[model samples]
Target: MIKYLLNQSLLSMKKRYDYDVTYMQDILRTDLGAFMKFMAFQTMSTHKGNLPVEALYAARIRAIIWDDCGPCTQLIVNMAVEANVDSVLVKAIVDRDLEKLPSAISLVVRFTELVLAHNPEADELRQQIIELWGEKGLITIAYGICSTRVYPALKYTLGHGKTCSRVVLNDEPVVPKKNPQLVGSHHD
Candidate 1:
């Protein structure tokens, strides 16, 4: 229902931004006002930065996971690619293989996770980030992580939240088949 409304809004905005909106249809359908606000903020954030784009993206990605926003998560995969985050790193993140990423990025992911979870270890993680990236860097990371968390919360509040089912390696999510025979592994 809301998805349908958001799609209508996107159709109107399509001329404004030259890109496919199909991946983001769910978000559009949920809340057009919030969607527009996010698009504006995303454009602004990407244009100016204290932290490296990849780090910002990593933080946002972690927040998206914390949000468990399926649509938002999938959308960020494309956004990260546009931001020049290496495809391999993005794949590692989607695959839950943080070990494959550089220590700095992986640390950012972990720290974001702790912060979102309100874990006591967040302070220690903050210190580590400060040592690695300095005061400005820490601030940049905080800004990115903090700012990125709002949308997902809003989505959840609106009851549009969804767990991501796709493991993004490229353009599409790898959705497993329900049938054991079709999926290649039988359940006991």
Candidate 2:
């Protein structure tokens, strides 16, 4: 829905991030070609269904990096799997408000995000689902997250969408202090 990196910039900047990579910050102020590609690769994912999501994600992400794809399917992938919904039918899901459907279903959305955000997010999702859906639920969540993360990232990278995502830094500014010994100690 939020098309283009301009708007996305505002949203992303408003949030606090955990790390600070120079290129991550540099990409935002400059052209999106490299930045978009980075995110598409970073956030990129693959579902593979009945197939391991990790493998699928790796391949999907690789395609964008190597083959180059678009973002339309990526958008669909981003939203569907979490709803326990099928991304292939994302265009015709009837109502696309699964985020507000019900906590029971909404949990899928949040859990899916965690999986992508955290490589091992599946562990937590599994633990939570163990009480209810049990082992099957955990596997399903892992698959969904992996599946969902791929396309959107791929699409953005390949050009399906036009959102530019960037990372900011919060750590102490690293000052390249001059080494007293290397400065003028020997200068007479």
Candidate 3:
């Protein structure tokens, strides 16, 4: 009964986002307890405590792009748009046009990059985030970064991950730019 309801929820998500949820379905089939736990963990990705929409989604989109450039990345982009983040800003982030992003958002993107890469430099950016948005906001961005990576990682581990594909925003396809600094850091 629980699996039935969960599958229905997954189907709704798949339809709403045009996303693939086969990995989630596989998890459900493999172990109900594990599937329930995974679903609980997914709540972290949506926690935006005290963060502005731009900052939260920027961190999420950046981290997902670092870990995946295909479906998972596109899913984040879609969610960002649905959350009413400006389509133009979403495009700038997708295109890696730091010049086009607002200073605050650009900072969040850079912070996500450095954190994902395990660089000590993220410390400075972290302080800046706390100043701008406070500790709760910092935690929100951290959760955004960490939780956003899990879907793609799980997909790849389950052999369901795909290669880079064109991501669309507002009905137009956008080619994502790879962060040169993070190139070869992972996903090589």
Candidate 2: Cα lDDT at 113: 36
1-188: candidate 1 lDDT, tens digit per residue? 65566577777655443334543565565667866776777654443356777777788776666555366666666678877999888766655467898888888877776676666777988998889878888877777776666656755665555544554546566331121222222122
lDDT of 2 by residue, 7-71 (tens): 36545633422212233445545656766675665432322334333223322222222221223
Per-prediction TM-score, please?
0.65, 0.32, 0.95
Higher TM-score: candidate 1 or 3? 3
lDDT winner: 3
Identify the superior model by TM-score, candidate 2 or candidate 3. 3
Off by over 4 Å in 2: 1-100, 119-125, 163-188
Query: How do the residues 1-188 of candidate 3 rate in per-residue lDDT, one tens digit apiece?
Result: 88999999999999999998999999998999999899889788678898999989999988888878679888999899899999999999888899999999999999988888888899999999999999998999989999998989998899888666778888888887778987777542
Model 2 shows how many backbone clashes? 10
User: Could you tell me how far off, in angstroms, the CA of residue 125 lies in candidate 1 after the best superposition?
Assistant: 2.2
Task: State, as a TM-score between 0 and 1, how close model 1 is to the true structure.
Answer: 0.65
- Model 1 spans with C-alpha error above 4 angstroms: 1-48, 162-167, 172-188
Best by TM-score: 3
**Clashing residue pairs in candidate 3, if any?**
none
- Candidate 2 worst ten-residue window by lDDT: 167-176
Give model 3's TM-score versus the native structure. Answer: 0.95
